[model samples]
Target: MLAKPAMAAIWVNQYTGEVMGKYDRPAVFKVASAAHRRLFGKSKAEGAFGAITGKLAIGITTIALLMIIISGLIVWRPSKGHVRNKFKISITKGTYKFLYDFHCVGGAVSALIITVCILTGLNWSFGWYRKLLYSTFGTEVAETTSHKTPAENFPAWDYAYSKLSSEYPDKEIRMYQNEADIVVGGCGNQQATDTYKINPANGEVSSVTTYEDKAESNHIKGWIYSLHVGSWLGWLTKIIYLVCVLIGAVLPITGYYLWIKRLILKKCHSA
Candidate 1:
């Protein structure tokens, strides 16, 4: 889906963390965002605040996708001693045979990537699913925010950023003062961010939590985009994902045709 690829276009420099196009999203990204996450611009916030229906939609669609994949596998069960032929694609066949081969072969090939995409895509839409993923993977979701108010004076955000930026020159730094302290995050790869808590009054950096300090869930969350877009292994996986995703998109159309044709034939026979 366009949404999967669009999420990959965050445009952050891994070196400087210069978030390019932070204010302006391209037209494709906007359209995909509107369709996939925002329900074509119905939901207000992308997160936990606004859209109940979007979450429901994701959950329902994910279930349906699971069913589709399972049923496809069922239908694609290879005949005895013919597993090799089942994967062979031939355009020379008639339209029905070609479509059937394409559907089965494509589904079989891309099933793993589609499963990974579905699983990775779930965290954005459902908190419960996220929690289940975390717990199942032997991690607890911890709140990174502290509610206590900082000093009356605003935290020394500039000083903190300077301190972190110099220490980790290769990293991209983001800093903000929450209720409790000045929180600074420095990251090299997008996933492995180090978090620093600074004192508001003294501008002192108190604690630094590195990526290694994080749990498996945190690491997995960071890899979600890469895994979903099939970029984890560079172009090799991307090509595989591209083929599989396109096939996935086409499966429903072919499936619907078969279902309708079957119905028509049954009705004709009865008549």
Candidate 2:
């Protein structure tokens, strides 16, 4: 619930005079997000324990994951000068050979991409990490936002729609009254959308903010978000990320097989 804002967006066909609306997210998304971020559904803030409420659980998992990646890479490191051997997947050798090679080689490659996703992701899992990013990048921390009611010149539905339609052409725009902004969707990254405030009296739209306009810490954070989700290079990185994620999903099962196999071998030797 911390990061999940359940807001429905309505779409209007200006020319046809038809309204289309639906839930912005799927029903399972709420539970999944809670499980992923907060873990126990406790942290009210994004901060993982504040020392974050709910994030402590995820922070522990994050630390463990970082350790796993580091250890995994060290184990995968080649001995001697046989670097070529490390990259091989021996299909004709045998089933075990093929599985082991795939697990080792695929996992080694997947680890780099997953490591990037994890490090960038940890920025949100802890407060100090975020500050570290700010200081490292020579940027000041962003100020916390507070809600304010929209001004009395609140944009009329038709008035705001007319202006926004042109401003973000072919994009889905949704106006939020309490937040006093129009969120323009489909800017590539989920967090990369642009927001604008409108003055209905004169049909004027003012800049609320856009990801591209962000500077210093916030701008770096946008980069972090893009890198985490693999949107920086558009489709190419996204495709690589997808393949790595799929391989990553298979890693644990392969690891378990190897582990059990080793245990049985040890038992046989002991007997």
Candidate 3:
């Protein structure tokens, strides 16, 4: 597919950290970010390609999955007095029944988590959906702040880095000198915090905003990614999400087997 190579390229860049040239990484990221901006009106922080083909593939897959869940719910509803049976798996009912219960019951249990993944994944691909989410949640998007300083009079990167590093000694800090301001950003052992602005004029830490100070919308946006990847609650939640994803991955294969068996049985019955 057109998008698979791009995905692989991104995966290599992320997990392997291999670059073709001195400026290869940033150049690749810039191209991917431009593609995303053209397609979705925003750039992904990770700089993955989220252009037309990728977005369409994910969007269609998400819709198909939602339809499957809805249809499964309709077909899975139990008779009024036998409601409990719908949730129970009976291995004693033989192989076909066992497979049926595994597919249905496991799917039912994991549906919500899978749905969350789909929705969050779609949000990453669709700008309209993201805008709707922001509006519904009453959250304003954060704007990047830049300050310009005279080229000849700009403070050194070392000075800004030293001042911010000394202030946040316990935290991990990354500093860069822009044309205007020396921007320093850091976080604790966990999530990334806000960017700290330094006055290039006097080498003073001018402003600081932590994660807690961000708007409700921004918080939700951050949490959406965490929840989608099962990182919000640490390793325990990640384990749970992993299991759910595995179950989801296996459902289609099992369902296809069941369908094929049904077709064979119907042919025998007709004969």
- Model 2: runs farther than 4 Å from truth? 1-20, 40-54, 79-81, 93-95, 144-157, 167-197, 206-213
Worst 10 residues of 3 by lDDT: 180-189
Best TM-score among the predictions, by candidate number: 2
Clashing pairs in 2: 43-54, 48-52, 49-52, 49-53
The estimated TM-scores of all candidates read: 0.70, 0.75, 0.67
**Candidate 3 lDDT, 121-220, residue by residue in tens:** 7776567877776677777543433222322223454566677667666666654343222222222113335656666565466777666675676567
Clashes per candidate (backbone, < 3 Å): 0, 4, 1
How do the candidates rank by TM-score, highest first? Answer: 2, 1, 3
User: lDDT, candidate 2, residue 87?
Assistant: 97
The residue pairs that clash in candidate 3, if any, are: 149-180
lDDT of 1: 0.67
Superposition TM-score, candidate 3 onto the true structure? 0.67
Candidate 2 lDDT over residue span 1-271, tens digit each: 1143433345555457587554466758766777777774743333443324567767777788789878988998999999999998998987667788988998898998998988887887888987887888888766543233433333464677677777667776655442234333244444454666665565456657775665656556666878898987778889999999899888888888888888998999999
